[model samples]
Target: MATFEEQLKALESVVERLERGDLPLEEALKLFEQGVGLSDGCKKELEAAEGRVQVLLQNRNGTRRVEDLDLEA
Candidate 1:
C-alpha cells in the first residue's frame, strides 16, 4: 500500500494531467477514477490521524476530548 504522502502526490499529478486536457477520454476517465480513490484514501487517513490526536489530548481523568485543529497554518 502506498503511504499517505505518496497517494496525495499521485492524486496531485492526476489532477495536473487532467487539467492539461491532453489525455484521451478513456485514459482521462481512468485517471479520474484513480484520483477519486486516492482522494478518499487521503481523507480517511487524515481523519484517523485526527482521531489519534484527539485521543492523545484527552484529560488524565480518562475522558476523551477534541479541540479544533488550526489546519490553516
Candidate 2:
C-alpha cells in the first residue's frame, strides 16, 4: 500500500487527467471513481493521524492534559 503522500500524489494526477477533458466519457468516469476512493482514503488517514496527535498531546510531559485541536487556525 502507498503511503499517505504517495496516495495524495496519485489523487492529484487523477484530477489533472480528468481536467484535461480529452478522455472518452467512460474513461473519465472511471478516473472519477478512482479519485473518489482516493479522497476517502486520504480522509481516513488524516483523521487517524489527528487522533494520534491528540493522544500524544494529552500524554506529553506526564501532564495528561487534553487539548482541543485548532484545525481552523
Candidate 3:
C-alpha cells in the first residue's frame, strides 16, 4: 500500500503537470483521474488522523491543537 506521504507527493506532481498545460487530452484525463484518487486518499488519511487525535484527547488527556504542515508558506 502506498503511504500517505507518497500519495501526497504524487498528488503534488499531478497538480504540477496539469498546471503546465502541455499534456494531450487522453493524458490529461488519466492524470486527472489519478489526481482525484490521490486527493481522495489524502482526505481519508487526514480524517483518520483526526479521529485518532480526538480519541487521544478523550482517553489520554492530550491537547487537540495541530500545527501547520503546509509547504506553500
Highest lDDT against the true fold, candidate: 1
* lDDT tens digits, residue span 46-67, model 3: 9998777666555345557555
Residues 12-42 of candidate 1 have per-residue lDDT tens digits of 9999999999999999999999999999999
Q: Which of candidates 1 and 3 is the stronger one according to lDDT? A: 1
Off by over 4 Å in 3: 59-73
RMSD of model 3, in Å? 4.2
User: TM-score rank, highest first?
Assistant: 1, 3, 2
Which candidate's TM-score is highest?
A: 1
TM-score of 1: 0.86
Instruction: Give the residue spans of candidate 1 off by over 4 A.
Output: 71-73
Which residue segments of model 2 deviate by more than 4 Å? Answer: 59-73
lDDT of 2: 0.90
Across residues 1-73, which tens digit of lDDT does each residue of candidate 2 receive? 7889988999999999999999999999999999999999999999999878777887546656657777799
List the lowest-lDDT window of 10 residues for candidate 1: 62-71
